[model samples]
Target: MRGWGDIPHFIHQSAGTLRNGPLVQFLNNIDITIMNKPADYSASEMKQISKRYTTVANQINRHRTNELKNQTIIFNLSESFANPNRVPGVKLKNNPIPNIEKIKKRTTSGIMLSSGYGGGTANIEYMALTGFAMCNFAQTLSTPYTQLVPYLRHNPSIIQSFNYAIAIHPYSSKFYDRGIDYPKFGFNKFFYLGNKKAPIIHQKKIGANSYLSDETAYDNTLNQLSRHPQGQFINLITMQNHLPYNHLYHHISHYKATVPANGTIAAQVENYAMGIHYTDQAVAKFIKEIDNIDRPITLVFYGDHLPGIYRNSMKKDGLKLHETDYFIYSNPAAQRLGAKNLTKHNHYVGPNDFIAMTA
Candidate 1:
């Protein structure tokens, strides 16, 4: 029968000679095992075994071919890793003193708006002007200047220009999809110095099974900072510290029992704390970048809205609910301009008031 005896000659031939004689002997034994089979085996049985073996061999061959292809592609891409031509040089020279003075001037009447998570009282527009006492830039502009409407108007031509603006709604992919077409708005010319696409600032959602990489987030933030510079205000809403958490404890196998009924509320708190730690690290890197830059930068950092983990859940975990909180970290320009004693107020503040207060 056409069985093990017909083991492909190419496979054996492709097996390279080993540097060690003993290893060669070991491979010979493997070849013998591949070749040898019981003569008494039925024709159907042999056929079934051969089919299974062939199926496995084909899968392995395809996998190996793909691996080689991927390796070659990676090697080629790596050659251009640090090539200067691949990375375009910045056209704008770093502006020094006036940039700082500009920030100071802006903050003299400027409002910085920051919002934490959740809907209702903590919405972005409401929080900016209400919670922070800043002006609503959106309200001043009509349909042509509205967030999604203008971008939808512009389309492909907007994409051609490097200038683009992206605003992400709290937790929706629809917003991002709409943002992809933002350049279509005629305002593209208004925002970009040249014909450029506007950049979108959005939030990231971290899943329970997901691994949080602060470095990746930092890289993304840096890339945004580099691209936008002074063109657009970049806002980042982070989910690193999001709650009702599950994935946070995946890394620690030992404490699986200690995690609460809903994955141990206390452990979840710790996980949330860890998430905040990673977020803080990311923010720290962002601050460093601003400090390094010669231009005056205003960075407002604060919570969108506090997580509502349920009163029962909190009691079960022996925790207490607290009022909403916000913090701002600004450049020396903002500070020198008298951005001081930004008090922590306890009230149901909305977005517009938030911006107005800060302004």
Candidate 2:
């Protein structure tokens, strides 16, 4: 698997990422420990590589045919994490999935079932969008955002079939260098807090980093979509619930943290709950506004990964992280046959399986 990096380079970049071109900029800054020099290939080999890429692409596109064509799809990569149930000893005043029971009736709901892999947002986003896990490449070559996303010229996302596709992140485009990578995933438009043309959200400070409120991000997304009349795929990666949760939000005192006072963990726990509360409220508000849209729409919301302050389910020795919650929401307009009522899924949903399961 160590030598297999070149295969993705050839399959994705036509020859290898060594040549002077779009991907060369990324390759130029590489350390040999991760990637050595690319194998030299003749021009004839480059032609063959292109042919192979086309053949593979055609086969994949054929196998993964799009199911929902005209329906609007919004996939929100919510930050941090929280479970549906109350953490023992903590009082949660806010419903994380606000009115989830009521909203469940309006659409199909289920757990996106994820492994306790501490891969973070970029890896999960790659899996959810491509329906392939990090293990597809070697785990050592982790984070497709930096490794694979920079090389690809095309994508196989379910949203490729949509008439319009856009990406919005209420954070820096440079955070993961997503500014350069999203286009490779077939996003027709990209908006971020760093982009002046994009709607800027008033951020709240969570520790040293400024966090954009989910409420404002949702409104900006809605505003962006208002011009497009459905058949749009919107990827919203949120940032409000990021780490350094030591600050206190008085409004959420009702959902007080039960952890020991004066510890780093206690502050994180308290601030985290408050952050989750705000996220829940944002979802409720987003739902209320989008429900009025005349076109059919499907919204999928899931936490990117568990935050840094918390530990996995294991008390002494456990590698597993507690799975985050994910729910698929179908508005009245997008309800399909037999999907009039919310459906529950019993199986665990891998991040890669999100596209197929949600569709």
Candidate 3:
């Protein structure tokens, strides 16, 4: 991972004018025809439908704001529960943890962020990349990675906002049809688990599952940036610290859960804390590397969803299940771009605003 970052590949981005105009028009026409009352609509009707669809679709695209330039962005989606104490404005009233006040003291910087309930990572995954809710596409709520993604080709994605985009995951491509969806979403390439496994740091088990550490995932993303330093975005989704905290890791941490220390639930909570600690270390390392580097980078780091653990850290703090955590971390270059208010408190964002928040 260390050596990978030094190697450099210079990439120049070419201008992208809409490439699937006719295809989009065709789909829009179909949509219009389906919406209208069924009649023996002639070829002339189809022509009018096509024309209308093209006009409306074009109008939609027109609303797209400009992309941020000269800055590399990384949307790093770490797994599982993001303790709300880490963010400001979180309050615990209904379901307070045993020692939440002390827990809050342990929290670092950033704003509290959340995604909608259920649908696992795909819910926020779709929203963050496409900036359109799963509900927006209807079928997407059910089969985003499989059916919906393959069907929507050349739709507007934040990927197009950057000159180059790459998706990095340290796990199998088989899950969630990412191999198909990522490309269509405009990612230039991907770094994921395959025949040749990814080189990950802290690859040890946190609870029961063996995971590719967040540190490794982030480092690989930097490695991608090293390969192509100019005008790039890296979407790094991690797999470490997933769920099912029923068992123990081969090499586990002694960090105890803040809750009463004797039950099965206590064990699970402690396991999550230990995993969170490792994630925190990895994040610190990742941030340090960016700070020392010469590249102009803007990073959006957050949890995709809450881990399906019993003591949801949110419940302890009186927050909803949808609320996980998110933050935009940028260097000096990005800060100058009217993003000075990033560290400002009370951001309170959701998955749908991911695109706008980063920009």
* All candidates: TM-score: 0.42, 0.73, 0.67
lDDT of each: 0.35, 0.65, 0.60
lDDT of 1 by residue, 42-105 (tens): 8899899999999987886673322211110000000000101111121112121132223334
lDDT of prediction 1? 0.35
Give the per-residue Cα lDDT of candidate 1 at 232.
39
* Candidate 3 residue-wise lDDT, 182-296, digit = tens: 8788877767776253343334444355776777777777677677878787888888777755564533335443442223255665556666667777776777778776767
Two-way TM-score contest, 1 vs 3, winner: 3
lDDT of 2 by residue, 109-211 (tens): 5555454333367777878888977554644464567665686677677667777788988777876668877878778888886677665555444334467
**Which candidate has the top score in TM-score?**
2
For model 2, how big is the CA root-mean-square deviation?
8.2
List the candidate 2 regions with Cα displacement exceeding 4 Å.
Answer: 1-67, 84-98, 101-107, 115-119, 201-209, 260-264, 311-320, 336-346
TM-score, predicted candidate 3 vs. hidden true structure? 0.67
